[model samples]
Target: MMQNFILCLQEAALTFTLKKYLYPTDPSECFINPPCGCLNPGQEFQCEDCPYLEACLSSFKLK
Candidate 1:
């Protein structure tokens, strides 16, 4: 059961990463939403060009 849980987590992580749905200034700014379609991971190699998500990382959330 633990292994299954881990696998689910891995899959969710992959989906999230692949879609690059990291929070933007808002959901409208999300890449998968509108006006940002071309940057979908595996579809385009442009992750390096994106600026860091504003205050969305773990270090910021804990505060």
Candidate 2:
């Protein structure tokens, strides 16, 4: 029950972020991790580098 709720929230957040900033790309598109180092505009190379990790996870009830 809780897992389903969390999934719903995750989908929502990912959707919102995609809509707001990455509207040009399709959600099904998977981005490959850089072999050395690379960065997206206004985006950190990885989610681990994001300061909003805790907030985003908690908001989605992710473990």
Candidate 3:
């Protein structure tokens, strides 16, 4: 029983770590090429009705 519990805990920890690595908790940690200058706080882009939406989305990359 204890061994199973330990395995479960390890699995949970690994899952959490993998998730953290796959998706950064902070938006500023994104790896975008050419950088989007129009990105507002909360990592939100003011792309609504913006002329650069296509270009911005094209170059956006997540680390």
Question: Per-prediction TM-score, please?
Answer: 0.32, 0.34, 0.35
Model 2, 1-63: lDDT tens digits are 999999999999999878766422332222233222334513654644544443433444433
Q: lDDT for every model?
A: 0.51, 0.48, 0.53
The collision pairs in model 3 are none
**Residue 55 alpha-carbon offset, candidate 2, angstroms:** 34
TM-score of 1: 0.32
Instruction: Predict model 3's lDDT versus the native.
Output: 0.53
lDDT of 1 by residue, 1-63 (tens): 999999999999898887644445443344443332345633566643444422233334565
lDDT (0-100) at residue 50 of candidate 1? Answer: 43
lDDT of 3 by residue, 11-37 (tens): 999998897566435444443332345
What TM-score would you give candidate 3 relative to the actual structure?
0.35
What ordering of candidates by lDDT runs from best to worst?
A: 3, 1, 2
Candidates, ranked, TM-score: 3, 2, 1
Off by over 4 Å in 1: 21-63
Superior by lDDT: candidate 1 or candidate 2: 1
